[model samples]
Target: MDVDPLLTQARQLWIELAGAPVAFPTRGVAVVASAESSTCPPGWVGIVALGDAAICTVPTDDLVGVVTRACHMLPVAALTDPERLAAVLPVTQVLGPATLAYCDDHSYRPQRRQPIEQLPVHHPDLVDFLASVPAEDAAECGLTDITSAAYVLRAGTAIVAAAGYRHWPRRVAHLSVLTAPSRRGRGLARAVAGAATADSLADGLVPQWRARPAASRRVARALGFRELGAQLSVRVGGSDQTRLGPGSNTTAP
Candidate 1:
């Protein structure tokens, strides 16, 4: 697919995921208070900005004016910048500042590493595979909770690598991939993820890769995914505040 159209489609998928209908401003940022946003934790704020434009989602209508004012005061880039966003929004808690990347059929680069298996997301061997990885990695990848068919690689009977997607509205396949610590340096991540990405594309769903780790992002890029936007989830309410850094959670939906 042409990069422009692919990117536009990707942007539309995020707009639909924002829950309440809203569009990015031509300049600065657009803030919308909508309780329907699934991308944010219940009662949290969500920001999805493609390139220079942005749309912010808050829980209540009362906060829209404040958030709009605060967000508009800064550059649209601040929504993806944790420190800048936290300074302005009433960020009581935060989830990620993940890079939102998208891949389509034309741009996809399939890997030759093979013998991959397509399994249902809830296969029993998957639990053992998840147990083998670090808790933080498991939390970040979220492979066990994916709703799409899994593309996995195995070592004997042990599943060493896995990739899949959660079926989001608007034909978005949010991708998740994880490799065992022992299996990290191998090309298994690329193989399984490439398989999953190909499968998602074949099913006519846009594959969305939200990655926090550089390695994970590298895998997506290697598969020809373009970084089109950034997603951040913030809980806004009382005076209690926390910032995103080493200690904060980076897990996102």
Candidate 2:
């Protein structure tokens, strides 16, 4: 499979952050390595692979031990190195795998030529409007100066959809989006996402759309985003925490 240049660059950044040698895995495998301090969540090591990467901040490097009991659940080929494979596995048994999607200027298409409102992060109305959404969504959309830009779609006085990006390493934009539940299925998510992605491209930032839903993937595909690959996430506890799909919290290119 042809790797997107942007994806390659993202992988390089992750490898550098991991402070480990690059080990791009084959089509259906994952690789794990020690991560630099604070590069990943506390207590876990960062794992990166072309197919299913993960950051396990679990404070221990004994992944081999964890996978030993579940050896039968994984593919034999994927167990070439139990320790490395464990790093990419779900931190817990309950949480399913996650995915990371991304797009560059070459892949993104700003097709939704609808009117989008660029709202000030500190605007009173925007602040009040964001309060109605999830805290993570508001923070991801630039609750402060950390965001590069944010855009929204309004119907009358109500904000129906919003999109934005936070600055990530290597000039990448971690894009996020949200659409009101009552206003979903109307393509509002795609419109706002396109607006924000276009702004990211204009500012020379690669938009990284990390999501886990088929619907969100469709919105991304509508805007010409491609699936870089899937990722895995397992919380320390049994809580099944995964990044929301497009239109809910995080969005695509």
What is candidate 1's lDDT per residue for 105-199, written digit by digit as tens?
88999889689998887788888777777887777677767888888899999999898888877788888888888778777888998998898
State TM-scores per candidate.
0.88, 0.72
For model 1, name the residue pairs that clash: none
Error of 2 at 169 (Å): 0.9
Candidate 2 Cα lDDT to native: 0.58
Give the 10-residue window scoring lowest on summed lDDT in candidate 1. Answer: 244-253
Task: Name the runs in model 1 displaced over 4 angstroms.
Answer: 1-3, 239-253
Best by lDDT: 1
Error of 1 at 245 (Å): 21
Q: In model 2, which range of ten residues has the least summed lDDT?
A: 240-249
lDDT of 2 at 12: 57
Per-prediction tally of clashes: 0, 8
